[model samples]
Target: MSEVQELTKTKEKPLWYVVFTYHNAEKRVEEHINSLAKTEKYDGLIIKAEVPVQKRTVSRRGKIKEIEEKIFPGYVFVKAVMTPEVMAAIRRINGVAHFVGGGNEPVPITPEEVKRARIQDDLSEEFKAGDTVMITDGPFENFIGKIIKIEGRKINIALSLFDREMGIDFSPEQIMKIQ
Candidate 1:
């Protein structure tokens, strides 16, 4: 027998695409998609699913609560090979509105876009009571104040204006620590 030539077919490459789901149902839709893919044995097509979220601190009645907020509401990012079977499987999941791109075709997002969408909290810096900070923006621009209270991004600062100490709220973007 002569030499035999074997022909092997390659599968489609996976790319990151954005999926639009019901409002406030990103987590649920992700779970459902994952469950469906697993049970239906389409795990190779649907590689990964994620919902970009950010930690936010909210203060109410003197109590501060840390909550995880989705960076993109009603949207979830999925990395997969967009095959007809994979698309059909995703459509069957509840709470899944449709892919971000119109029509049956879904568009892939750039890696840079994915990074930008993921809003991570920078916890390296900390401000405490009596710490001096400079107001960088807003009405208190160029003014110096002492930190009265620190609630995540919101800082309650006491500024001396006209010989009177007044407390004002400033976001992390509006203040820089001096000491």
Candidate 2:
């Protein structure tokens, strides 16, 4: 690519923000933000919204199904150097509960943190679906589960909490990432 092309692409990145969205609102929030991006309300302000997604597996009567699951429930990441109008539009977006930072002041998601959650495509595996594991933390402590698949950072676990065999979905931070 030419130097000018590289420069244009580099300008696309901005300070990132960790946003707290309404329950089950990650997709809608992202869509709204992206749509607003084309309007003049956010002129010259560039924002990249991301709702990290993962894959999930479900079993029904001896059959398995795959589903797309969000990595951070009720949360979405936005990369943009916020201007006054940009911030205003963000709050107006549907399914946006609030920003994690204190007050209305804008905060950016660190480049390092974003990089930490980066996808590892080469080392990926269709994890041995159905391997039992124990939850190390979160609200569900000491809980054991059966792994259905390993999709990015999320895991679809078949957990029996009091004989109710329900499927619990979790991210890397919510459980022990290691075996």
**Best-fitting candidate, scored by lDDT:** 1
* Per-model lDDT: 0.73, 0.66
TM-score, model 2 to reference: 0.55
What would the per-residue lDDT of candidate 2 be over residues 1-179, giving only the tens digit for each residue? 86444444343324568779878888888887767766676533644577877788999789999988777788878765576767777888877878878787967755467776552322122235666555656888657677776776678888887878888887643443223
| lDDT of residue 49 for candidate 1 | 77
* Candidate 1 local lDDT, residue 179: 27
Model 1 is weakest, by summed lDDT over 10 consecutive residues, at 1-10
Model 1 over residues 31-142: C-alpha lDDT tens digits?
8766665654775577667888888999989999999888888998887778888888787777888998867798988757866987232222345788877776788786
- In model 1, how large is the Cα lDDT of residue 33? 68
Clash totals in order = 0, 2
The collision pairs in model 1 are none
Error of 2 at 35 (Å): 0.7
Model 1, residue 93: displacement in angstroms? 1.2
The C-alpha local distance difference test score for the whole of candidate 2 amounts to 0.66
